[model samples]
Target chain A: MLQCSRLSFTYEDASQPSLKEVSCRMGQGRLTVVTGPSGCGKTTLSRVINGLIPELYEGKLEGECLIGGEPTTARPIYRLSEQVGSVFQNPKTQFFTTDVRSELAFPLENTGVQPEAIQERIDQVADLFGITQLLDRDIFSLSGGEKQMIAIASSCMMDPQILVLDEPSGNLDVEAVASLARILGRLKDRGLTMVLIEHRLYYLDGLADDFLVMKDGRLTEHLTPTAMRGLDGPSRQARGLRALNLDANEDASAPASVATEKTPDLLRVRNLTYAYHHDQAPALNVDDLTLSSEDVTGIIGRNGAGKSTFASVLTGLLKPGDRSEISLNGTKQTARERVEDSYMVFQDVNYQLFSETVEGEMLLGARRTDLFREVAQKLDLERLLGRHPNTLSGGEKQRVAIAAAILSGKRLVVLDEPTSGLDLLHMNQVTGMIRYMRSLGVMVIVISHDQEFLAQTCQRFITFRQGRPVRDSRKLGNLLQAL
Target chain B: MRPISIYTRFLLVIFANALIFLTLPTPLVLAINIYFCSFQVIVGRVRKGQAWLLVCLVFALGASLAMVFPENLPGHYLLFLFVGVGRVLPLVLVAAFMMGTTKVSELVYLMRKIHAPQWLVIPVSVLFRFFPTVRHDYAQIRRAMKFRGIAVTTGDMVRHPMRTMEYIYVPLLNNATNVASDLTSAALTRGIGDPGPKTSIQRIVFTRLDALMCALGLVLMGCGAYVAMFQA
Candidate 1:
């Protein structure tokens, strides 16, 4: 069992405690998902439980956290590793090795596990994660979702009593989330304690036994799965929480603009094809694809099924092969030309935020400053103008990237996985920004595996398979299930 | 079913690099050094050809200018740059190959096998992971610069030198600053500091290819030494 009582934490640099007077018990053989709006102290509470607060992050701690009823303070962080396995938010951050095989062996080898036994464990864990094939794969070469799976698999290889994952599903597709949920269920059946810090709710369906709601440094609300299931749409929305259950038959796909009439295609591509190697079949070989300024188009597919590659091609990051062409407003376009005409907000927004301050970032390459205040206010970035872009939270960084794109006066904006780690409030804000952009006749293309976000924001959908668009959909449920 | 031992590969790189720099028989040493590079590219699939570009740049502009106009002031300077830079490319090629092929964990495995101290092994392993990540981050930083309109071309650098430098370094520093802690934490969680016998999944077998590469390196070095002592 994982338990914390009267837990409070104040970060070294900050005056206010991030987690205040929080108390919770995660019973053994149970899954507890702690979630809330951004900066709600869910992460802080998790860190305290995992013994990183005073142990790693220099911070004041009050009250006590016990893993398996023993004070976390009783053991060193490395000693606690035997009892609890943790996966952090950024999958890229925790990895120490260059490839998957060594990443798995790292923990085992550290604990002085026998060589043959380590290999046995690696095989067992790989089989469990359904990633035996990925053991030889390069860590840097994996997709965001693949990296997340490997992160989980690496953590689980220790076979700790408690598994604590911070937003493991954020980067995952529906299929991958289902797989994770199944794995968590199996681990729970084996009497392991599971504490998941997740933003998405739909995938946890029957797996989560309890939900802990943290709000502004306090564990304000706790609900059983039954009570959580009773939350109506408006209440959940009001609380800034995702749907407990979205109706399968709901038609949240087509945007209102699409109902009115069709708009002219602002972007068009003919015979778009790209391949990494000479011998391999093209990862992408689309004959023709078009997007109109009328609605926000969502590109939905599996994690590495070429959605991001398609975005790269569209944004002109990846140049198209010969005998292939791209055009904007009937004008033939090169990669540089396309890049000049468009902005792509990468999934990891860290790369896009270059300016020291938010205001400085907003002022970059802008034609007009009149709309700056309104955009900033709409994206909840007004309060962050004085802050360094590097110091902003993940959601704030994402918003800053979006704000940067908005300020750049680009004709087209492509957002790749913008809502992956964003909470409900920020998701709504991002969806609103996309709508605002669409209303202003700026063509927006969103590449994401977030079905619900797509259901809310996107009017048109294109599903890809083996790097080519297999079909178009106006229904997100089908897209979610199809993969 | 068997791959060459990582330690054996590292030894070959070190020995071959030593021979190249010794210049006992300059041509043979150069051939041996370049062969190791080609072996990495073709067999290990560690293809980083920018080192080749460096060689071309040094030889084409520097060496050719020196040869064509040896008496001229510009030729003298070019010759100085050529001789200074030309000798370093072979070693750089070998370093790149070592980095590209050997992972941090493999290095750690070899270090423990040789009973290296933890402090040395840990940092060395960390450094093996560091260079590749720096290269990746550098690319991202460059891409971000281009997208953000602070393109670091010669013209832009000349115009806004400080801003261009800021654009290049600040993002990289900020991005990788916290990576140290993350790496430390990851290493800790894995029980890296434990004073215990470390184990690895890699089977360190001396393959035929390994034997062949070692033999070739030793033979070339021996021939170079013989020529250096007696013939030269």
Candidate 2:
């Protein structure tokens, strides 16, 4: 369904070509998985097949790319929209409407499809994607997995013969990834060809028909999954889905230290309840929650279940009006006053990055250079001090935000979705930082949807449903059961 | 918090005090305020080395023009036009500084500290988040247009601004709504409206230094007001 012949593309300003003499062909109704290390032009190749090269990104194109026997370069992207649909890496970027139903109807409307046809397609795709219950919900309110699913469903509404997905499940949970794989399997059964560009192969192993490997911007190997697995070498073995040598270890809770006379709890909450004006449900309703100096609390819930809201309230970003009473180190305080005592690394790094340079951002509210040096060394941000915050990659940005929050000298730190866009290496670094925070006797609360992250970084888990803390457990099994 | 640079803070305070004087009710004070403000804004946009010369030349030309043509007929209209320009120019310059230098999150934080109502805080925060996201959306749309081989020529843009608006508006509205929902959920999750004194880790306290600065601002404002009232 897709073919590229000696397709070399060099960016307009760059000194070297992004993709060099890359040649590959993808068969119809088959799933082709493209895997490569970071910065190997995986995204560049996907852009080429989708007619974004030479067209969207200004570049020198030297070769032909054909989609289903038609030269893609000759056809406008709108025309190609009928034959190929693409879902980008970030779901937030691709959406064109507020509600799920309207989002599903967007592409069809652009293509001048009749209203009836559009409605019919929306219904069909919604059913297929199991998003009927989500049709009326605000698009932004949906969880990350839900948003990705909607993005996929919206693309499916175009009824394109081929679907191209760029890291579709990059930020999803394991269950969500499994769900995505199942969806892909069903799509394949319907004879829809797919090209998935991904780094993690946990979910794509059995489903992908063929493996296409690119290294240094060139097509290095193209073979069936079985054939690729038979090859030798550590790189090949890594590509073929051998267990990664990196530690994926979950936190084995330390043997209960000899109980010294317990010091008084440092933080206490009593009858804490909060609800938004528009919400028919409460966001958080916890009765008598307490944390000692050494508690590493993990807050987990479905998206929009108020985990982040709880963190914000605890961190003093949001003030609870009448629904909660919070005593910090035994003193009642307002959100503004609490700001001096608690810090938060927001989910979106952009909000927290207020300065032009990394050093300035890290030292925004910092009092001591010693604290700054400690976090800067740990997060490896000392070298990045001169660079602009926006210039850094996603992982780099996350680290910078973490470093800044830590340097703020807040007694209690809350991290919201800290590992969302991070790779294994960066994720390990952040997990280590969390451990370090706990070792300093600083109370830490992590709000995340990543079960693995929570399992690895935290000792206690709290689950919220409809803004109410329904379960609290130290055991992973109990946490799972509660959720 | 890192102390605001002394020079920048001084400029801000001076500019703010000058703005307050210009906005005062007296006619004479308003006129002088306008005159000086106009000089500041227009001259500010010019490079520093040549700006003084340009300002002097403009001033001389205006004075000469008024002296040569002192007739009642066009002089009143000219005066009115100059005053209008003067009144607008400083406001525009200051607005630019405000928009460019102040981060939206900081503005929201300031508003929250001032105890703004939740309804107001919610919308403002939403707008702040949506601005960047919308800009990103617009960029993506433009890229999509280019990839689709739709030539985004200037002529086409001028002729079909609606088409451009269509591209911008659809995605913006979509993203805004999504962000709003996210904000709502985030707010709700964070217990934003809980009725107790909430504790914050990152406190924006008005330090002794900040108090002293505020006192200096008040004193400056008092002096400006006194000078405007009696010195002239």
Candidate 3:
């Protein structure tokens, strides 16, 4: 069993503690999920459990953490690695090597394991994760979900007694999330304890044994899967939690403001095709398509399905083929013109934020002060206008980027995975923002795997397969049923 | 041929660096470039050889131009500088070959086998993993700049160097800081700080290809030394 008694931690320079009087005990082979809003200490608790708090990040600790009945803080992190394994949120930064086989062997190599033994362990773990075919491939070429699989496999090289996965599904698609759930189920079958920190709760319906709800640096509620299923829509929203069942038909989570009446075609495309290299097939190929400002289109597909490439082409971040043609409202526009009239809020919002302050960022290249204030107030950024853009939380940074896009008066806005790691409250806020953009008559395209978010905002659905738009549906029920 | 040992590749790179300024015979230079070009091809990097071939053509053209033009031509110094860079191209190719083929695991194993200090080994391993992430981060920042109409053109840079620089620098610094901490934490949690002697799953051996390359490197070094001492 893993136990924590009155666990409280404050970072070295912080006046407020991130975790306060938190206590929980998770039984072996049980999957316990911790869900909360951003900055509610789910990550801090993971850090403490993984021995990263006092060792790498200096902080005040007031807690008792026990692993198999022994204090974890008493042992060094390296020593604790034998007992506890950790998989972080970001898949791109956690890996240490370039290839799958080598990355799996890395932890073993560091601990002085024999090559033959390491290879055997690798085979066992690869078979367990059903990733034997991926062993010979390069880690860089794998999709986000595949990378996370390897990350988990590498973390399991030593077969630790417990695994701590912090938002492992943050960067995954719906299919990948299902795959991850299956993998976790297999791990749980092996009697390995797991603590899953996550925001999306639909995928873990049957897998999670218990749900730990946290708020304001405290563990507020502990519920069994049955009790968690009993939560109503309003109560869950009030607690800042995602829907227990996506099929619950929570209309309250959707936008209250309706989209404006259908306008003339806002953007038109013809014969768009792009390939990264001449010798290879095109990554994106579209014969013809037209988008109206009347609908918030949700682009859905598996990883590498050319969803991102389509978005790039629409936003003019990537140049289409020579024969391609794009026009905005009957006006022929070049790539530069498309770029000027469109804005993209990247998934990693940090890259899009450049100015020192949020107010400055909204007006970086924009001169519309009146619109800036209007956008800020709508996105609830008025109180955070003076704070540095990088200093704000993830959701705040995303809102600031959207506000900047609004201030620019762009004809189109594309938000990539806007609610991937956000709680219910923030996801609702983004739904509101998308509605506000539509109310302003700007075309909105959200590239996401979030069915809840999509159902709440998107009126049109575009499904991609192998770089082609195979299915286009206006009925959200069709897409949701297909999923 | 089997994969060559990283040690042999390292020695060949060192030899190329040492003989860069030496005025070797044409046959010797041709031999060195050919061997390295074939090595590149053998490593499945045929595309890389095309670039080196293009560089060689430029160098050949410059040398022929210098021979035909007057000794006191106004732009002769510029030609000299161009040839000077070409003279060191072989060394640059050798380094690139090493980088493209050598795996981080092999490098780490070599360091540990040689009893290198942890301070050096740890940073070198992290640095190898760091470059690709930095490249990705920079690409994202550039895309962001383009989307925001930050003027990523050369003319804009000349007019507003500070603004352009700031636009690129701020996000990069933030990403760098976050990546550094994340990498360090990942490394530590995987028992990288263990005091015990490290081991590796990579099986490294000096094969016949490595021996052949070492012999070739020695012969080139000898030819280079002879030319420097006697021909000059």
Candidate 4:
């Protein structure tokens, strides 16, 4: 069992304690779900449990945290790694190897485990997590869900008594979330202690045994799933808790603006085939494809399955082969000829930002002063004008990129993985921006693995597999089940 | 007034530097050179106070040296500083400002507008995108090192520079390979090599205000050039 007695932690630079007198005990062989709003110290608590708080981060501690009846202060982080393994929020941030095999072996090697033992554990964990096919694959080439799965599998290979995941499904689609839930259930059944910090509560239905609600770094309540389900009205202060009670039927009652309808085709691709080099396999291939301007389309596929490549092609950031043909607004143009008519908001916003200040960054591709002013004011970027581009947070940078793309006055805009690191609030803000973009008669294509985002925004779904378009469906439920 | 193309802007800056080099006295040339070279902190349109303060200090030092030293000694010093600072600093400052303010798309648009060869813009855009990826890869490698108990201290870096290079280069090369593929696809999709004048939505027209500014700049250049010719 894990126990904390009046645990309080204050970072060196922070004015107040992140966790204030937080006391809780996680029982052995039980799954606990910690739910809270963004920036409420959910991640901090998870870090503390894994002994990263006082060790990795220089901070003040004013309480006793015990693991397995031993004081946590007595053991260093490396030592605690044997007892507790943690998977961070961002899968890419924690990855140490290029290949999945080496990635799975990393933690074991760190603890001086035998090579044979490491191999044995990797095989067992791979089979357990159904990642055997992915072991030889490149780490960067994995999809959002695949990467998260690898991260979880790598942590489990450590053979820790407890596993702590910080929003494991935050970047996954609905289908991937279901897969994650099943994996967690399997792990829970095997008697592994699990602590999940997540905002999406629906996935925790069968996995979470207890619910721990945190606010202002303090544990406000520790109730069983049964007790929490009995709460009446929307009085449940936790945003995630309220979302759990939402019936599937209520989703249909939402305004028509929630799921736009497919209108006339605005962009069409005929025999679109693209390859990086003459010898390499084609990055994208489509016999005949059409996209409507009015629909919010969700592009779902495994990593390297050409979702981003398609977006790049659509936005004129890439060139297709000679055999490839594209028609935009009934005009046939080669890939190179269509670039000026499109805009793209990149996955890494920093790559496209060349200006010193946020204001200058927004004006990078803008032509009209009037449009610039309108976009600037609408995006609330006027306040951030004087600040350096690099100084803004991840979500702010994303918004600036979106504003810039909108100001470019292109009829078509492509957003690639725009919601990767955003919190709940920022995610809402970004979705709102997408709506605004759509309202301007722009043909917007969103490339994301976020199922909640797709369900809340998209009306049509397109799936890709093995560099080929597999399915195009108008029914959201049908697509979710298919995936 | 339309703003000049990037090529024109590049030439204009070169001309301005040449004029400054010719008209200013040996001491002032050295002062201006040092000022521009060390004024990296005062980039873009904003006036950074710290950079301005540093420029003033350098100016005072140059002036004192010119006053106290003999003509030959100060002339040699000024000549050396001028070559180092004056010849290189202005170009560096101009390049920095241009790069720091111009987006890759804007550059692509301008290049396409001027009918620059596809080989030129394609390679340049790829290089531009490569820089940020390289920086990100370096950071990832550093974090991976820290996790592996390899301290990236200055002493360690100095002792094993080759190892440090390996640490950065290996990951960088790996990432570059992946990014290159993505960039190629992106470039092709955008119809980069399509025939005819590419219509850019960027709309970089030379407004009346831009023309007036360019005219004033040209007049300044003309005066500087005449002064340099006569004074010499």
Question: Largest DockQ belongs to which candidate?
Answer: 3
Off by over 4 Å in 3: A250-265, A277-282, A367-369, A478-483, B20-34, B63-80, B152-166
My TM-score estimates for the predictions, one after another, are 0.89, 0.61, 0.93, 0.62
Per-residue alpha-carbon lDDT of model 4 for A1-483, expressed as tens digits?
Answer: 988899888998989888999888899989998987666778788877877677656789888878899987797566677678777655554554356876676566545566677788889999999999998786666876888898888778767889888888766666667788999998888989988998777668756899998878888888788776676434553353434543442364213443334354478898888899889989899999988777778788876778877876776656787878789768897554556667767666655554668887677557544677778788888889889776676678778888878877767777777776555566667777888778777787888766555666677779887777888977455334444
Which candidate gets the maximum lDDT versus the true structure?
3
Query: What's the TM for chain B in candidate 4?
Result: 0.64
Using lDDT as the yardstick, the better of models 1 and 2 is 1
lDDT (Cα atoms) of all candidates against the true structure: 0.78, 0.64, 0.85, 0.67
lDDT by residue (A194-304, candidate 3, tens digit) is: 999999999899999999999989999999999999998778888888876887853533443364665635698999898989899999989989998877898988778
Model 2: what is its DockQ?
A: 0.02
Preferred candidate (TM-score higher): 1 or 3: 3
Error of 1 at B5 (Å): 2.9
Worst 10 residues of 2 chain A by lDDT: A240-249
Question: Can you tell me the CAPRI class of model 3?
Answer: medium
Q: Between candidates 1 and 4, which one is better according to TM-score?
A: 1
The reply for model 2, stretches above 4 Å from the true place, is A5-7, A20-23, A62-64, A98-102, A113-120, A130-145, A171-179, A199-206, A211-265, A278-281, A292-295, A321-325, A439-441, A466-471, A475-482, B1-232
What's the residue-level lDDT of B118 in candidate 4? 68
Residue A166, model 1: Cα distance from true site in angstroms? 1.2
Candidate 4 C-alpha lDDT tens digits along B117-160: 86786687556545544666666555333322234355777888
Extract clashing residue pairs from model 1. none
Model 2 / residue B32 / CA error / Å = 38
